[model samples]
Target chain A: MVSVGQHENIEILSHSEVEEVAGFVGNFKIKVRRKARYVTEDLCTGCGLCQEKCPAKKILSEFDAGLGTRTAIYLPFAQAIPRIPVIDRDNCRYFEEGKCGICAKLCPRGAVDFEQEDEFVELEVGTILVTTGFDLFDCSRVSQYGYGTYDNVLSSLQLERLLDASGPTRGKIVTRDGREPESIAIVHCVGSRDKNYNRHCSRVCCMYSLKLAHLIKDATNAEVYEFYIDMRTGGKGYEEFYERLQEEGVIFVRGRPAEVVPHDGRLVVKAEDANLGRLLQVPVDMVILSAGLEPRRGAQDVAHVFGLSRSADGFFLERHPKLGPVETASNGVFIAGACQSPKDIPDTVAQAGAAAAAAMVMMDRGRVTLEPSVAQANVRLCSGCGECVVACPYSALQLVEGHVEVDETLCKGCGVCVGHCRSKAITLLHFTDEQLLAEMQGALRVLEVA
Target chain B: MPEPKIVAYACTYCSYPGADLAGTLRIQYSPHVNIIRVLCSGRVSPELILRTFREGADGVLVLGCHYGDCHFVSGNHRTVKRVAVLRRILEYAGIEPERLRLEWVSASEGERFARIVDEFTETIRGLTPIEQVLA
Candidate 1:
């Protein structure tokens, strides 16, 4: 991603958003809001001088999942592209206490700028690809896990940074009190597949939890335990990795943990051993909750920007499940990665390539075929009582000059208007009354024969 | 005695797949149901439902997706209101409103679909047959 952002052809617009999107498949006009970074983009060379001189350094680092501290004028992470640190005006002392200009005073190339404001820009494009990604299901909602209350119990992302070499503890697996854990317990599916939280199994959690188990056990040599309802490692070398972790003497408890409680001066993980038909409480120094993923926050707003629809699961719905995985219901717009569903990195990358290809095909062809099954209003037979207008779910119908009109682009041809029309004036283009009657007859034919 | 005849109008996106899932899961229910799949529950008009009853169907079951989970956005809202009015019309026509039932079943709810069919079938069996009532 850093390499791509640095490419001469690719103009990476960080800290920007799509404010409005207009036009159809082949041609589109986009309005964008480029948020102020409080630092001028062109004048600044990627330098660490401003960061070293900043006085305010206690704000939580969002990139570290809030597990680490960063200076007010700091880059998002060590590996962030463009390497330019944005002055966080909200937390910067110069903006708040008004007593600091150390970054401006100390900069060698005079790159720090504090007087910038947000700007808007518009662009015209042929196609769009949406890959806004996903948000982790907040483990704090499942209060029974005691994620917020218990200091040792951390979310999976928090644990990822905790285990990273560049992280707070410098890659050491230790308790919050700077002591190595004698024992650890990793709980799986804290929010996914529980029916009360999320119905679908977050496909990546099982494998990652197993991977974490391996990493923690190897790093600290702690007696690690994994409490899971099931072990689903359905990927290349994933099942083998699970087997290796098991062979490495990690205790795999076959059940979901009921609760995490403070007991005997340590956190005790309480769960049922379903295979053994017994309840067990395993005391551990630390706990890691393998949380699941949901659609990114503001997913609905993003969908509205691109004229897309979301499925019951709240992920962006595709045009077709198998045949058009990358294509959205809206022509020329495509969706990829975790924004579409909870998938791992490989699946996300593969889908991204497919989405890019889908966009390319539409652009190259310069024309595309839409489904002919659109709603049509018969003006001659129309009473224009506006019943169909009221019943249309898409708002594609309207009373125009005492007759109903259909916006062919917006109508999905669901036939709700046809059913509600008092005059029998509205008809779905392909799925007409005659077609439905034929389908009904065909369905009942077997019963008649029997 | 002849088995009670039922005409079921199921939304193609949710309830129809739910019925197919019931078969896939081997969840047995009454086989007297004649399934007719439509694009949306809102497309199942009172006229079609009434015509089924007039054609000697013992009961009419209109199944759709859940309230907020409608495939056509707010299509099921219209279905809920339409079915309520249809039930009143049946009652005023000297026919039992229990003969016409409206349910919400999703694609993943195979057991719920089977259970709903079994319960609706049993309820219709308890009521006077539509053929006898017309005679």
Candidate 2:
């Protein structure tokens, strides 16, 4: 990211969103809306004075996943690209009560700009790639886990921040009462692989939970128990890591916990160990829910803007799962990372490279060929009934002037409109009624011989 | 009706592959299941299903990807909605709605594909033949 920021040919527009996209493949004009940072990115030398002396320190740190507090005017995190700080306009006293401007006064570079408006940036591009990433499933939604209710119960992200060297506790595994825990329960599959929640298995949680168990044991030597339905260690060298954790005395319970309750000042986890066929209520000082990953918030809006489709699982759908994993239904658009599915770092990076390569290939080819088997509308036979328009999934058909028109680029030749057309005005190039009927007859004939 | 012909529309991505897997695994199922591969179950319109029924097929089974696994994003969504409305239309037209059934079978679910085929065939066998019902 630093190299990309420093590169002469590359431009990084931070705190921005793609507001509008127009045009087709190899000729897209994107309108990006850059949010007002309230601080000059160029002038602000990432010197850490404004963050330290700022009076508004009660605001929760987003980077810490709400486990730590930060001042109103601060960067997202220490290692954020460009290392520029953004003012919290809502919590900033200068904006609210018009009183405190301590960060503006203490800044050495005088880079604060209160009057900065959101700037719109327009870019013309050949191809587009979407890597919007994912959001961790809200653990509190799984009421049985007692995530938000129990003080000692934490999300995996919170434990991650706690395990960080520069975190609030300086890598200490302590309960809310400021005492080191003797026993900790790691609950896996929270909001994953359940009919009530997400039915898909979150692919990366098992390995990361093992890593966390290793980290916690190494730091606190606490008795760690992992409750999981299945330990999916399918990736390279992942099973070995699981074995190593097992050797380190981290207990593995093969069951999804039924519930977590606060009992006698400690959290009691009730689960039926599948292997033992016995129910166990283990009391622990702290509980960490290995939450699942879901599609990023507002991914649907992004999908709509990019002319992409999201699968029923809420992730961006690919063109073909086996052949074209990164390409979307849209010609010039591609998808990668957790936005597509819950993948690990390696898989996400691999998909990102594939998506980038797909875009580059489109750019190199210069032009794309429209499929010959596209739908066509006969204007003369049109009855002005818009049944075909509504039946077309791609929104390629439109009733213009009492006649249906087909956008060749948008149509996949699915033949849906042809079936819906009462007047038989619309017909797909290859998949006509006669052709489909012949195919169906050929398929049904084999049973007649018996 | 001799064998009660059943026409099944199997999606190429999911159900067709599942059928192929069942063949490879030598999973025995009813021979009455006449599978016709389509790009998606969504591509099988109500007209095609009605035509199949008119052609003396006792039952029409539509199978595609499980929910959330559609290769065309939400192609099965269209299938679900189409079949649901078609079922209601069939009921209103005095034909048994059980003649048409929709099932989801993924590529990895070979056993499920075989079971679905067997179950649909049985359901069709239990019903009055389409020829007599519409006569």
TM per model? Answer: 0.78, 0.75
lDDT of 2 by residue, A121-238 (tens): 8999988989999899999999888788889999999999999999989889899889999999999998889878798898999999999999999999689999999999998999
> Per-residue lDDT for A106-220 in model 1, tens only?
8777767778788999988888999999889899999988988988999889889989998998899888888899999999998899889888788999999988988898788
Scanning candidate 2 chain A in windows of ten residues, the lowest lDDT window is A412-421
Which candidate leads in DockQ?
Answer: 1
**What docking grade does candidate 2 earn?**
incorrect
Please report the candidate that would top lDDT against the real structure: 2
Candidate 2: segments with Cα more than 4 A from true spot: A19-23, A29-31, A40-50, A94-122, A193-195, A227-230, A251-284, A303-313, A376-411, A416-426, A443-450, B1-135
The deviation in Å at residue B58 for candidate 1 is 4.4
Error of 2 at A79 (Å): 1.2
Report clash pairs, candidate 2. none
